[model samples]
Target: MNGRSIATSAMLYTVTAATLVFIAAPLLVTMSLSVSDTQFVSFPPRGFTLAWYGKVLRDPDFQSALSFSLWLASFATFGALVLGLPAAFALVRFPVPGGAAIRSLLLSPLIFPVLVTGLGLLQLFSMLGWGSVPVNLLIAHILVTSPYVVRTVSASLMLADITLEEAARTLGASRWRTFRRVTLPQIAPGVAAGGLFAFMVSFDNYPVSMWLADAQNDPMPMFIYRKATGVFDPSVATVSTLLIGLAIVVVLILDRLVGLRRAMGM
Candidate 1:
């Protein structure tokens, strides 16, 4: 290779290595702290033990928060898919007036500050006299997660082969039939990717859950935040490490089912 090409390749490798270390360092420290035999979060743990993990496992508040988080994420992903798929179809298939504006509005949550969205939802719920905490969380999570579904489905739809749909139509297939047999299969990977993204977003959500949660119904992120800021225990590290492990497992499963490159629209 030429000198210039070698220089560019060296620069890219250095940047990639730096980026990976930057991201992984904190997580590695947290994992180490979780296994350390220390009362407080200390680097270079005095000794290694799994007591912190045991403590987190037995904590009732943690259990409740985890259960609530799982349910909320599941509900939010389902709702996002239901609401977003139709919106995606309309935006992609139909050339409505101000179509770009409508699509932007649908995806505004991704760009808008999450705190602002949470506060706005709080006000809306207060005005409507909605006292149901779980229901409010469900709505907030749906609002945040729906954009992932719309964006992914829109990309999939854009890449889809229109000739197949045309051929199906020419064969006397109904619109719904064509969608189910032809279009749905083509976009299924995108839908699955979107659903996974939505679920992960809702699961780890804190700002919106913080605004909506009551004393009795804290989500996992809120629970973790309180534990980290209030008590500052290594048990929190254990919980975090476990969650990170879960997230990694989920990503591996997704990569197994759909090529990660395709899922990311790369």
Candidate 2:
């Protein structure tokens, strides 16, 4: 390679290394602190211990929040898949009236500020006399996460070959059968990818959950925020490290199931 090309390659590598370091340093520090024996947050451990992790695991409030977050994320993803798949098919296949407007309406949650969405939902629910905390939060999560599923599935459908469905229909297959056997298999990766994204978004969501969450029933993010901001302790770090681990496992599962590049449309 020419000297200029070599210099440019070196510069790009340096920049990429620096960017990774910048992103990873805080997470590394948090993980390090989680094992520190110190009573308070401290950099570079005075000693090492797992007591904080034990404390976090034993905490009833933390357990409650974790359980609620899991259930909420799971159901939100399921609801998003159920609703988003049909919306995607309609938008991609049919020449529905006001198609552009309908697509925009479906995807508005992707652009709207979470705080605004949460506040609006709160007022709307109050007016409708829906006082159930779990139900309200579930609805909010579904609304927010459905856009991801719709966009992913629509992209997958756009790339799928249309002739397969026509061939299936010509060979004595019903519409539902064609979709189930041919169309769905083609878009399964996108659907799974969207579900993963939905689950992650719902799991980490804080601002929306903040407005809708009840006093006794908090999600993991809100619980972590409260612990981190209100009473500073290494226990927060331990819990955060565990959450990071959980996120890593989820990403690995997504990669295994969908292949990361394909999931990202690369």
lDDT against the true structure, per candidate, is 0.92, 0.93
**TM-scores for the candidates:** 0.96, 0.96
What tens digits encode model 2's per-residue C-alpha lDDT throughout 70-101? 99999999999999999999999999999999
Clashing pairs in 1: none
Clashes of each: 0, 0
On the 0 to 100 scale, the lDDT of residue 61 in model 1 is 95
| Cα RMSD to the true fold for all candidates | 1.3, 1.4
Model 2 bad stretches (over 4 Å): none
Q: Which residue pairs overlap in candidate 2's backbone?
A: none
Q: Assess the local accuracy of residue 235 in candidate 2 as a C-alpha lDDT between 0 and 100.
A: 94
lDDT of 2: 0.93
99, model 2: CA deviation in Å? 1.2
Candidate 1 regions exceeding 4 Å error are none
